[model samples]
Target chain A: MSSTQQTEVGYVVSSRDFLVYLDGLPTIKVNDMVESDTGLRGWVTSTFEDKIEVLMLDEGAIKPKQEFRRLTNRLGINVGDFLLGRAVNSLGVPIDGKGLLSRTKTNLNLELDREALGIESREFIANQFLTGITLIDTLIPLGRGQRELVLGDAHSGKTGFLIDIVVNQKNTGVICVLASIGKPAVVVRNLIDTLRLNKALDYNVIIATSSSEPPPLIFLTPKTAFTIAEYFQKKGKDVLLILDDLGSHAKIYREISLLSNKSPGRESYPGDMFYQHAHLLERAGNFLPEYGGGSITALPVIELSLSDFTTLIPTNLMSMTDGHLLFKAGLRSQGQTPAIDLSLSVSRVGRQTQDQMTNLLSTRVRQVLSAAADLETISRFSLELPPETQLILKRRELIMEILKQDPLTAIPKQIQAILLALPFTTFLQNKNRSFVEKYKVIISEAFLKHPQLIPITKSITKLKTDEELIKLLEAAGAVLAKLCP
Target chain B: MNEILSIILKDTYSLTSLKHRLRILQSYFLKTFFGEIETSVNMPLSPQDSNWLKSLPSSFYQKFNKDNIYNIFSGLEKIGTNTPILTMHLAFELNDTTLSQIGAFTRKTFDSPSLLLDIKVDPNLIAGTALSWKGVYRDYSLRAKLEQKRQELLEEFRKFLR
Candidate 1:
């Protein structure tokens, strides 16, 4: 290691937009870094005969015949717990105006596109990943290492919902990494401010690229975020990764692909679009104890066109993920703040981590909601219905009312279980939607902090059946009844 | 090789010069065959092109018919693709005689007359030359030699500073 280390050099032959083709550096592989004479940086994208293509990572010009030095570093970014509470770009440069990150021994240089662990190194997901959302916890349960797609149309409260999830992970020991790809500057600023205000930034890392950045830099956002997440996950820490939206990521890739002469496939996307995304996402999973025993729960977001999930990108994401949660602008307009369209959403691996009582309750809740939907269609004729049908309809109303939680609120799992079973208790018999809306916060606070109820809440897992839990809740309602009376 | 191909190699001593000749040939074909033509360089042939044509004997023109025109182009293209380029950086620009002298020496040394030279004017070289061949760069310039003795130079400069 002499001070004057001999490095391979390349010369730019042709350039178009952000893509530059070099006629030399015969040994340069894809994703290796190269620095121009003007000090701009680029990542080698592909290698052709006697030439290689590069995507510029910085905001600068690389002219034809300009010289470049091939760096030994492959595609990588710096990582550490010091990255917590800071915002950085794809190159690991701090963008939050927070100067440099504090020096820590945990700092590491991790590859941005490291290969994922194979099935032999992966363990089955055994623990539940909680977002503190009552409806999701009770119905579409998620496992600690599952990759779930969060999808909806624009303005569907998707970002707000994602922020709620991050905020709710406040003290849960789950490290959060949010990759905000090609979002507006204000959105990133507001997100940082919100996280800081909630004190959630202490445990969160944000990798952001604005829409105005170079396409190549924006294209690296999600991969950099995943790299940071992998760092924490390998340290035996649970990580929650949120890719704000991959729709913009796909478009950037398409632009890069079409410019580099890749033939377009369906929807004008490159043929390897699926492989590119799947490769990035496959890095997330639960590792076996022999492989460090940690889990990475990824929520990759995609915005649909006019709520059409049948589009190519959305369907591709759906097929790759364990399940999807479809938010709806229609519901958001109806005042369902952070509106999650329930019927369309599915969770493939979440049910496995749920307790038996929760599994039973979820089945009953689904049955009632399904029957109510079918009966409501028939009841539109103003025909008389049986007493059981009326009770089912009333129960559906109560369930929907209880599930309408405010933004930034994270209800505990025991409280969610107690709240969902309350409709079965005698306490909520005469309660209307307005009544539940007015008292839901007070009820949740009481259940969380009440001296007599904490034991029952703690013992929720011990209760074997949904009826047994409902019975315990009915008894707990006695204390609430005295207070609310 | 055909005499026409051998003729194209004469005075084409650099990649830049070869590219210029290729562009001129393309423009010529565009004007002669296509109804319209557009190139980075304008359609009109310059003195250099005329000089190149004059250097060729009349037998070359008799050989340049439409049927074998592609044979000539494909042959030129093959030479362009295969010829290795050597880049040199010097402190000052060279005169045509100096360039031709340097070109002759390099052509004789490398044993390939068709090899191309890509020269760059770099004032920082300071009275010597830096060369890059096939991406391997070696700086034999006076500046590099001085930089190698930078520590001793700095120690001498410190005496003046004090």
Candidate 2:
């Protein structure tokens, strides 16, 4: 219970009177504003038979909780105020060394304990959440109020992709809740450090159940995280909930089953595992419609062996998601970050939920990439192909030259559109030398008008001395400009 | 001869064959009492008198000069008491008159009861025949029980075989 009880030291955030009791010590008055001899005032919030929960709003807060575990001296207990951009444990003690967390007890309750207030958007998906990462923004674009499962083998960049998405959320103004269940303490430490270093922790709320904690407590970690997200959503803020990996959470269910005397199924997993995974993921959908307008976007990660999609965990999530972005292990070995095999990865909601502009850009780029793939496949079949086959191969080589991009870097939408619509189709089709000479000016003029097409234009500009590639770019640019316009 | 017997059993199948065999064997034994054996319309012994003959072993009764066909065979046939059902696994062996009596009893009970009979030969039973009915396996073999008793005592049956 919380009350507006002000003390001489600082403000108290409770409604009911609490007796501060440090076990085996004399009890202090519930309303007393006690202070340490060290000049740090302690504002007590609640007291239990074993421990006292106090908030020290002063500059010099109490020592870390772990250090005081053995001490019997209870000289006015105090913990510093909780602040954003710092890693704190469940008891709201700072774990990351980024100093005490700044806290203001809100009139509203922090833990939203209510069962889902019946999602206002029964089954509606719109208003995409943009993660400024290029490969995702361009290809499998994420939508608000949808659950996407990123499934892959271990060491395939699942956590890396999640971190990238969380970091990129700064641009979209979305609040993030990263819930790590059954993860190592070191992982939580590194994540907190990374978030703080990037200043992304200012918008992030972390809830962790480390491997050393009891299994039952670890099981409730993700649910506690969603409750926090729901609190943000009620205040009309968009929230992103990322379950670092749910496979271990399912292992907790299997442990519960074994403890409860149930027979294990394949791979020692419980028989009712489908329901466990399905219910958890189904909770991640949009709760409030655009009319009332608040959103929760979920990205649940599934780990498999050697990127095998047939594993029970991966298969169950694959069927539940709006789409999946697979990170291939082979690509990761090749020093590729976000090692997505683009040809195999796809978004089901590609054109379905996108604006007309993004769809037009993505479709043209996809077609050019597909064409390049086909030509590359055929050139291997015939060793001694004709001159026309050679010409097709050359055009394909030019397409790859234009499409190659670094995944971590993002290209803006307007630029993405211009690159797809380069007027090189006509020049690549040019046969007569007179037509090549005449249309070369037409292609250059088109590229000069759209700065977005500068990358490909610069490449073709370099190939001006090489007549063949110049002709290819002019032909390709003509075809794309007409199609895109 | 085996083929002829199979064909005859296949065609003229009836309970009368057992009765006919009983009469023929009874006539041979009747020569011990009468000077010559005679095929008679009626049996010399009553049903009550045949009951004692039924208890006698086939080895002891078969050596008698008096007619002993149907008496000994029908005697051992009275061993099994339960009715046969549609699906069952039963085995038969003619060790002494007990085996013949069992065969006759099973034939009468299971003829119209949809039962299957399997015959096996094992001389090592050493005494009374063994019967396995339905799922229950019974061992009336003296040799088997002797082997078990010896095994329980942790002794080999090597001396008992000679």
- Residue A371 lDDT (model 2): 64
Question: Which parts of model 1 are misplaced by more than 4 Å?
Answer: A1-6, A102-107, B1-82, B96-98, B142-162
Q: Candidates' DockQ values?
A: 0.30, 0.00
Candidate 2 deviant stretches above 4 angstroms:
A1-84, A88-94, A97-120, A287-292, A371-375, A384-408, A422-485, B1-162
- Model 1 earns a TM-score of 0.88
| lDDT of each residue in A234-322, candidate 1, tens digit only | 88989999998899999999999999999999999999999988988898889987777889999999998889999888989998899
Q: Per-residue lDDT for A288-375 in model 2, tens only? A: 4453356678888877776678877777778877788888878777655677777877676534666665565566556656766777
- For candidate 1, please provide the TM-score of chain A on its own: 0.96
- Cα lDDT for residue B120, candidate 1: 89
True-vs-predicted CA distance for residue A54, candidate 1, Å:
1.7
True contacts kept of each: 0.28, 0.00
Which docking band does candidate 2 fall into? incorrect
Q: What's the lDDT for candidate 1?
A: 0.85
Which window of 10 residues has the lowest lDDT sum in candidate 1 chain A?
A1-10
Colliding residue pairs in candidate 1 = none
- Residues B45-114 of candidate 2 have per-residue lDDT tens digits of 6653345345445765434443544454455233211223221112333343553455456666756322
